[model samples]
Target: MRVKVNALILISVFALSSCKTQVLPENTVQTDIKQVVNSADVVLVDVRIPEQYAEATAKDAVNIPLAELSNNIDSLKGKKVVVFCNKGIQADQAVEILKKKGVDVYDGTTWKNVKAIQEEK
Candidate 1:
């Protein structure tokens, strides 16, 4: 038997294939980020590996690897989540994944820099 690729599937495949996987510098407003962190309803998650995170994740940051994000949706929903990976690709992907699930998300590089911003306040 032969199978045909539907137009929607083809379009989706092309769309995702064309999607950029690069990690850009964060554009999430810092002032708003600080406000949200103070709200105690936000989660700053380090999506890198445990070893990397154990090296130095932020004060309130949680270490939940990117590959496991789907399994931990309940912990991410209905809150502001700042996701960070080693350099940022995984974090960007996490932001997209969470946004699709109706979660408010941000993509910062890592807890190190994010903490700098928080400390500056």
Candidate 2:
């Protein structure tokens, strides 16, 4: 019937719209505290405001805060982007955004975790 056809169309549209790009695991991420500090081909982005990044950010961390993530997305295309925030909230949000946009992104999470991981090295 017409109603069934309409419902099928609606479901198809919903499924297509809800489709999300692939999300690589955090471990597969190439950018970490060690790679950031030791000088490598890493795309370490601080998803915080410029002020927060300038206050005391990781070495060689590029400032592409969450607010400007969408606009500056092109710069992240086809690259391994690792995002982080002060306490992991914003970074998690950023990871979702980047994944939807079909970017290869990793969650760097909190500074405490980054420091701890680095110390363990």
Candidate 3:
């Protein structure tokens, strides 16, 4: 019985390990953002709150706070959405949410980074 329990535990561990999600390298993610930044149809979304968004953000970036993302999915359809926040944390979470809903989404790291990319263009 002890051996059977150990074998079951091992199998479960292996299965869980195999289910780990793949995260793209930072450089690779940056490359993806750069490639799409200049596209006319691309949508830059700032995931910060309305107050923070009012202060400053990338030009042409729509204000869609992280908490409101799900309800606003319909507005984001048919466009390549790039999400960013004050820092990269909220943006990363937003990317996961959007990706699950089949939106063409990319993490733009931070609002500052997205603004810089826009200025470069």
Q: Who is ahead in TM-score, 1 or 2? A: 1
Cα displacement (Å) at residue 57, model 2: 0.9
The prediction achieving the highest lDDT against the true structure is 3
- Expressed as tens digits, the lDDT of each residue in 51-81 for candidate 2 is 9888876656788889899998898988877
List the global CA lDDT of all models.
Answer: 0.77, 0.77, 0.88
In candidate 3, position 57 carries an lDDT of: 94
Which 10-residue window in model 1 sums to the lowest lDDT?
24-33
- Sorted on lDDT, best first, the list reads 3, 1, 2
Candidate 2 positional error at 31, Å: 10
Give the TM-scores of the predictions, in the order they appear: 0.67, 0.63, 0.74
List ranges where model 3 is wrong by over 4 Å: 1-31
Q: Worst lDDT window (10 residues) for model 3?
A: 25-34
Count clashing residue pairs in model 1: 0
Q: After superposition, how far is residue 19 of candidate 1 from its true place, in Å?
A: 20
Against the true structure, candidate 1 reaches a TM-score of 0.67
